[model samples]
Target: MSDPNGPTVRRRRLGGELRRLREHAGHDQAAAAAHLECSTSKISRLETGQGLAKAMEIRSLLDLYGVTDESERAKILKLHKNAAEVGWWEQAEFEEILPSGLGVYVGLEYDARAVQEWGLGFVSGLLQTEEYARAVFASLPLRPQDEIERLVKVRMQRQKRLTQANGPLELWAVIDEPVLRRPIGGPAVMRAQLKALAESAAQQNITVQVYPANKDVHPGLRGSFSLLEFGPADPRIGYVDSPSGNAFLEKDKQVRALVATFDRLRAGALDPEESATLLNTLAAEEN
Candidate 1:
């Protein structure tokens, strides 16, 4: 739950700049590593934003890359400094659960100016109520009760971003029809959840659309995916989370594919007003 300019995002921006500089200088990882007296893997990790670069190390890399522009060098150095700051998710409470790429995903979500999500089997996490989220986690066999609570807490905390008045993250969600019909956490929980979802969709920054079950097969049948947008400078990120694994799509081609899929899904889905009406109708049925 880091703020917009979180460390993870800064690391990515800096890493991208470094990679660009190196490529422009015609230096591969091997050459850069030799210049810095570090292993190639270290260079790779920094370029991938998986590892932070120390100021001295960044300076050495800049020097090696033949970066003569003082202002550009200063900007890169500032990125390094900002990326070194500790993120809120690094707190002791989340250490155990965040080892997976969820930490990075959360950071990106916080820093994102907007997000587009397609939910195939369940409601989007950003729209889930506390009880609905708790039930979803508790359903996992043999999961500790404490762990379920922590997961729910993390989900609820993420929703707070939607409520922030200053530049609240714009959310566009496309939900499959079956997801709304499934009585997660029993009918009562779903009833409340649906009502809440409709209210959320009513907000200025949030848009909700439903893909009817009656339609022919669509791209979303492949699975759920999300696109996180950080405006022009940073690359758009495509995200996929499933039981098998989680993937963050950073390459332009991969992100573009996800974008195409989402656009198709949105085209086939109900309009926002109709989606809200359907949610209300379904919620009423649960009573």
Candidate 2:
């Protein structure tokens, strides 16, 4: 049940807290719903940040789950109040209910001290050129041109955080070799994109690596993911996106596994110096 109203940042935060409470209590959707006298589907929706949980309902659920810590209770209650607040994105008519995990993505991006990403099929949104972004959006059927432009602009805005005067985000990204070879909007657009990437890589806060097809082995072959290291305010979080939606790996075991995989992949990928050489070589070919 996607909410046409869209989720507010507060609602997203509450949803995340609810999920943590349920997981900590060892209760699945059915069990939690039974305790709350609601349908399991509703519980699932609330946990995923797709819908809001009534404050009273959240209170009852927390009490029933034996969550006794006063500090924790206040935090969850505060989140419920916050979810009622609106965000700037909500002002846009084209706003759709982004997956619940997307809230986590935004939250982490805002708070992360560092971020590492790897992409296999296309350029990561943070680094995508306007033409590249347009081409990617064009692949979707029936999107209004206005909405496409809005999205592109929104994406460009996100890059500002990386260039802010105060401590900008420390970003490291690696792309598969095929990503460079495929002309997203044709040679002209790709040439510019490659050149842009090469230039951006020179920034002290940014590191770009390339994993060539000839690499003997790499853990990234499993799929693309990101590891966001937060400041003391929050713990590290890992994210994996798929066509259906996204998943957050927060549990120690899962986060560790993904981190290990990323480490292995990084070791196998081209070093920064070598990767720059590869980028320059490809850019020359395009010219």
Candidate 3:
């Protein structure tokens, strides 16, 4: 079952560990579920990080798998307990979709060695200026002012990970030119956003590219997506957000296809230097 509350990074980690253990023991989903006396679907969901695993359930599975090492078993049990802990977003009461998941996403971003993003609509969250983010939030229909403010604040906080003391997170972003020309929040706000984009592009750790409307072909014409490449310990993952909800892709074949599509889109987009010039020209037009 999908957790309506969303899964935490700890939960994701635990799920990964559980998957490794099951594979090491040569137990398929049906075999593991049978050992735990649960539905195979339940084992599948737990391994995929779509649902939480109870401590006792985890313990039972570990025992059934013949895991006799006390240290390893305790470590796995502790991870399960941590996974069940509440995240900071749960305290805010914001109605944003994936509130709990956002915390995990942010944590992943913080640790990721490199991030590649492509957007067909508005700017990616990490690239948006505070003003742009606030305007975006305000445009949401009938949102409470307090809730909107909270969401904007959360977004801004997430951006600090890209600029703070631990050192910049490597970022490469490709956005449709139409996103720049859409005049979100009117001329003044749009101009500011364009300028912000130019400034961000100047940063050594960030690369911003634009795919003009006149481009003959591009893979990202379909929709927005992001590919996050983590350090050695974690696998690369692809994320796509839509009206229904966010989808995370981790299967090797699917992620490889997404990466290939992004590479093609990049090939068709303006190079970083040219993209910066285009942003500056657009900003000048707003003046």
The TM-score that candidate 1 achieves is: 0.90
lDDT of 3 by residue, 1-287 (tens): 11212235566678888989989998899998888788999887798665787788898889877899999999998778767865445454532533535655665565566789998989888899888898888887887888788888778876776786555677899999999998888899999999999999998889999998997766787789889876455689898877666778899998999999999988889999999999999999998
TM-score winner between candidates 2 and 3: 3
> Top TM-score: which candidate number?
1
Give the per-residue lDDT of model 2 (tens digit) for 1-287: 11212233345457777888788888888998898888999997787555777788988999877889999899888777767655444444424633345644754565567888888888777788888888888776777788677767666766766787777878889889999999988998899898888888888988999988987667787788999875453457789988777887778899999889878777778999898889888989998
User: Each prediction's TM-score against the native?
Assistant: 0.90, 0.79, 0.85
Candidate 1, 126-241: lDDT as tens digits:
99999999988888888888888888888888888899877888899999999999999999999999999999999999999999999997889999999998866678899999
> Which 10-residue span in candidate 1 carries the lowest summed lDDT?
1-10
Q: Give the TM-score of candidate 3.
A: 0.85
* Candidate 1 CA-lDDT value: 0.89
Candidate 2 pairs with clashing backbones: 10-83, 11-83
Give the candidates in order of TM-score, highest first: 1, 3, 2
